[model samples]
Target: MTELTGYQHGLVLGKFYPPHAGHHHLVRTAKERCARLTVLVCAASVESVPLADRVRWMREVHPDVTVVGAVDDVPMDLGDPDIWDAHMAVFRSAVPERVDAVFSSEAYGAELGRRFGAASECVDPGRTAYPVSATAVRKDPVGCWEFLSPPVRAALTRRVVVVGAESTGTTTLARALAEHYRRRGGIWASTGCVPEYGREFSEEKLAELRRARPWAHWSEVTFGTDDFPLIAQRQNELEERAARLGSPVLFCDTDSFATTVWHERYLGGRNPRVEEIADRVDHQLWLLTDHTGVPFEDDGLRDGEELRPWMTDRFRAELTRTGRRFLTMSGPPATRLAAAVEAVDDLLGRGWDFAPPLPERR
Candidate 1:
């Protein structure tokens, strides 16, 4: 083990409402200067983000430090000694060990250190390194998307999935939606569209069969009951990966939820495993591309022209049964795209409704 250096046991405490880049920098600075650092994440009962989530995010970003959480419902009043004492009780209960140093970027660092009988070390008190705060993040996450980590981004990204029968413009609409967002430029320039993994899997299976027996056709490739679960899992994994790296809004050609419907269309029954996998992820909106008036061109892999109406109805039934917010797009290609874009714009207009934090005493 490495020998102790600088302060014996340092401390950093904050609400960590969403754990922004500024908070991360402060913790990293303290960790390098102290042998053992304890980060106390103090959250109130009224905060939107959960205390456990904040603790988990902090631990994920800074694994070297000891991260703990405490419910500090005591009202904030820097001038009141009794309030400070009450808040300190909560902090002390969470961290009873000796604190040689208290690191912070807020004005309360001096008083906090004095009360704990430790040196107060302020890092970037002026927010020069990263001009971001939890308040700013809560108000407009898209404006401050650059400062967020992947886990937070994944949690906040608005996922929009497009599902429909074969060749009904699901892929076309998904790509068009992503392109429309990208045309907005700025932060929206990095908008992503996750292609259907199931399609790729099908293509690979056909290719493999062709190598073994060149006479094998697309219809010859059979799907086992277990294959749907794998498809759903991979589709979810792809969606998550794209969400972590993409813009505020992520578009999916088809998601795990759509996989369940396809499983029923192929195998004639519900697979509990596929349904369970579908329920794991959350999608904000579903655009069901209606098969009416659209011609289904047989792409070798697709053999479900007659099953188009049945599949469309199944999608609508499942979407409604599961209480999912969705819109069925019909008419010409341009009309469908326009309606889809309008729905997405409306979804974005309704800003993330983050519950306000507890009011602080002025």
Candidate 2:
């Protein structure tokens, strides 16, 4: 379904799991700039949400672009980088053939576009090879907001990540917060309140992560909103419209807590040097999900079932001690947000120094 565009054609590939503001940023920018936007949604991703939900997320952000559902049916085997080779072999039989431009989030994606004989350009907001990964997002989505923009964060109603060790109510909190936001009429992007990443990709990198990294393979995969590239995508979307829209506040769901956990568990210990570079963000917004009565389940990644109490203690002690602007989500999501917002109100409340909340991108 590639026709009726002002230019000639365009192609974009992504899992678009509960697509966030960053996804919309890139797509809307590409759509307006290109002739036609051909979107390929990874049909076989391991997300709990349906393909329709993924598509629906895209629609929520950008209604104009044409989103194509996965056409080729393949096995769910992820430990196969050779899959790209095999899938590429299927080539025309697998996805699409004709396109003038291809947009992607990875360097490899651009390389694949070149193989498809299309003009390839990477769409990451950060030009750096290290991007905010989907894996990071799945680990702890809300805490990762430091990596996202305000609009993007707003769109990530599903991205309220509650991170910590065993019994911290990470899953329960994620779900509860997600529900709270939805009741308030916002889109919540998340890994279904559990920790998983790269649910949709070439299966090659995913497989490699599963094998070689095993304990930390999923650490590298950040969501579309977790890094500079995602934010840059947001900027360009507006830049194309007006050139300078200032910096957008993107909300990240997780951060070093995710990486730190992986490193400590598998790699022996955390590094001060890496922490220096990784400890980047404006606030922590920590929530001690571990209360006495909360129940936790071992959702593949986490093994904390008697959720709450212990995990909460650790997260609060370490993260809070970091000397950052962190406020624990004390009660329910609504109550926590209210307290946080009110705290902001106290700080910026009646100050003539404050500016109104920025107008959203058109």
- Summed backbone clashes in each candidate are 0, 40
TM-score of 2: 0.37
lDDT of each: 0.93, 0.47
How much is the lDDT of residue 262 in candidate 2? 32
Model 2: per-residue Cα lDDT over 1-362, one tens digit each = 34454446777776654354456556765686576676777644434445675665565456677776653334422345565565555445535657777777654666677767877766765634334555455454444444543333443332123455554444455555444433533222221222222211214444666686676544464332223333323322332222111111112334444434433433455555435434532232444443544445444444334434544565566666675444565665466556544443343232222122212222
Best candidate according to TM-score = 1
Best by lDDT: 1
Clashes of 1: 0
The sequence of per-residue lDDT tens digits that candidate 1 reaches over residues 1-362 is 13556888889999988889999999999998888999999999988788998998899889899999999998899999999999999999999988989999989999999999999999999999999999999999998999998888888899999999998999999999999999999889989999999999999999999999998999999999999999999999999999989899999999999999999999999999999999999899999999999999998899999999999999999999999999999999799999998999899889898888778798
